[model samples]
Target: MSQTDVAQANPATRDAEVLIVGGGLSGALLAAQLLRLPGRRRILVVESRSELGRGEAYSTVELGHTLNGNAARMSVDPDNPDDLTHWLTQHIAAGGWPESDRQHLPVSQLFAPRGLFGVYVQQRLAEAREQGRARGSSVTHVQGEAVDLEIDRDGARLSLADGRQLRGAVAVLATGMFPAARTPQTRSSGLNAAALDPWDVAAMAALDPQARVLIIGSGLTMVDAVVSLEQAGHRGPIEVFSRHGLLPHVRRQPPAWEDFLAADLSIRRPRQLLRALRQQCHAAQAQGIDWQAPLDTVRVHIGRLWSQATDVQRRQFVRHVRPWWESHHHRSPPLSAELVARLHGQGRLRIHAGSYQGLEPSEDGGLAIRLRYRGSQESVRLAGDALINSSGIEYDWRRVARPFPRQLLARGLVTPGPLALGISAAADGAVYDARGQASARLFALGPPLRGMWWESTAVTDVALQAKALAARLAALPL
Candidate 1:
């Protein structure tokens, strides 16, 4: 069916058994799983954006923006472990790529483009709709922003920005990550045109190639913006600013299996876990394997460790080790890493490690950014024609100025987690209110719940959460 016809159907205007607020990867996966259930249960997904499958993270048009992890590790299907690998092979075949080149690379080392992954997800959703399953418990995609949610004795009422209301027996808040927070100096000085949000495609496309660009943060988002500039044919010099100025390490193919971490090893404390990981790294190196293999072993246990950690331990991890951990754990794809290397080799990309002090208007309508470097009491300055806020999602819930979450917290319907990183949620994905009561009807399953679960961003971790949430929603009394 045409997209216009689907919009005209308006099945989401009616009541539904399950109402999903976000149509990102988690929501789409959960919707697909719900359709597989035996009994009938209506599933309506309300997405603020026009596209259903491509959320902010996966919506890039640039082919250089590939998945950080390998294809073999990412799959929505828990039962079919090689689902993404099979999809990659089919995709390459359809694209007429040489089979000789495809067969040599390990499935675990293949890095697919983000857009291709989005297309794969859309295809899966389409296949689910083709079967008779979607007809009974239909998956309706609505294009509207959910502004307010009213939870009362008679289920939940969702208020959209366009004055429409959606009633559902159960509502899931899978609203992914919060948008990057803007600095006050940029806002008050009328420098909005100079400072761009990385996700704002329209603004990015309007940038002039001659203009000098300054990216705010030096992480995955910065890598994405740099890649987007190159893909868009921009040739201007780019400067990346961050507290540590540390770029993501490149991901490489893993070597033969090494015995470092036992499958059943359970270390909850941050200090103890770090010590054990360091020891494992040395052991793996002596056995002719890189330390990263053992770290990958630790990644499998991160969720369990986070759940068992005390508040003090969690704070210790965040305060003392999160920066180093993030840079190493979230490695860049080989293509992106090569691009950065080339840019640095050509002297077009400059990275600065410092804390942003402020920004001032230059004489020629450009921006002069002030920053304080490490071990320096004095401030330094850099001039740029345009600046991009490529910092990843702001985890502080209190800093989020959006109306939906602000209203929810004001009404005691939601509460921030122990460290105020994001919304509090139980281990089963059920959201906890201010009274510390888990609402069986409301659940959050994504990076927004990072305060409660530290390892919730990657595709594999989120897929597991989606599966667990799908089971819970399926078992709900309707």
Candidate 2:
């Protein structure tokens, strides 16, 4: 059913029928699904990291770093809502992750550490691999970065950073989100070079215990940075600069509110939806219920609402409501949020409403930065012994300074997505090429489809996309 090209470099071993450009959560989930089906085709996954499931999000070793959502909501199996919960239950029963008892929360609502979650994902992939092995199907991990790709009538040829090449009938771009602090940018902001990685607790530990630390952005990432600082025993002042100066709300398992979006079809515009949501929250709060109850209902409808909005409406939403929406929807975990709240209340973590201009010359032998406060035109200067650019992920592929994205854009292999949030792709994750043609051999999912699906980075979002994309690839004649 699948046509795979033979690798001339090694005639004895046939090339993969499907080549995944990344081996992160999205790639691993997709591979697991593809392997589960009754097929004898070979699959190849190329990743720069030594591990497959621990992408940028899960690679952190800190136990303080937890998933944004709880186990019930973070399932890799789309068909089974309690897949993660069940796995976590068995995992705990086996005396694994004894740290999970701190909160005394149930397994369903317990927030698993990102490192442990990576283990769960890897175990799932391992099970799929064993199942595939018995069926004569095989999946191989190519430990290299894919720098370039060429697609022709015959198949796809991928060139890696180590001068190795792989050919396959179909190739999927599962490259996950590139964090702003780590990824190289087209226009170098000396910030990344000077700032400490938000997840790097070891580097943070090396700093002075009382060193004033400067931070950028006040979203979930900023919360993580604060957690890292606490773990590193750094107790100095933290200055956070963002345009809105807003922090993410804590994620909660609130009572289920009525699905108002599904019941009412007339509320299509962004403004209309906002008004209705406010009423729902207000109503819920009036009844002594959690305000998050109503907001939770909107998660399932975001895809339809985002995809159907006009370009003008989309722009309006981005300019007017995006900040608020992000802070509310993409919330922080309870423990992390509590730490942030405590720090903020103690005046140690001060949030300044402003736009970061750039680095300024330091006169006191420390890193200096300047930013214009929200309502003022004049710039304010601040200096600290250490800095962290927790400005979030870099989704725009064009601005990424990596060799692969640069080569893809230069060769006209793909185009920028809507609002420049990721690569352009069709409804079913088929990548749109330079001329707006959906390539049959190329597919994408997860964060790469951020522009396509407004809420594409969550675990549930990636799992759903992985399942659908796997089914499509299996049914494809190519």
Best by TM-score: 2
Per-residue alpha-carbon lDDT of candidate 1 for residues 185-219, written as tens digits (9 for 90 to 100): 21233333457766455566677876788887888
- The TM-score that candidate 2 achieves is 0.96
For model 2, how does the per-residue alpha-carbon lDDT over 62-121 read when each residue is reduced to its tens digit? 889999999999999999989999999999999999999996899999999999999999
The runs of at least 3 residues in candidate 1 whose Cα sits more than 4 Å from the true structure, single-residue gaps closed, are 1-14, 96-108, 131-135, 181-193, 199-210, 256-266
lDDT of 1: 0.76
List CA RMSD, all candidates. Answer: 5.7, 2.5
TM-score of each: 0.90, 0.96
- Model 2 Cα shift for residue 245 (angstroms): 0.3
Residue 3 Cα positional deviation in candidate 1, in Å, after optimal superposition: 37
Candidate 1 clash pair list: none
Cα RMSD for candidate 2? 2.5
Candidate 1, position 245, lDDT: 84
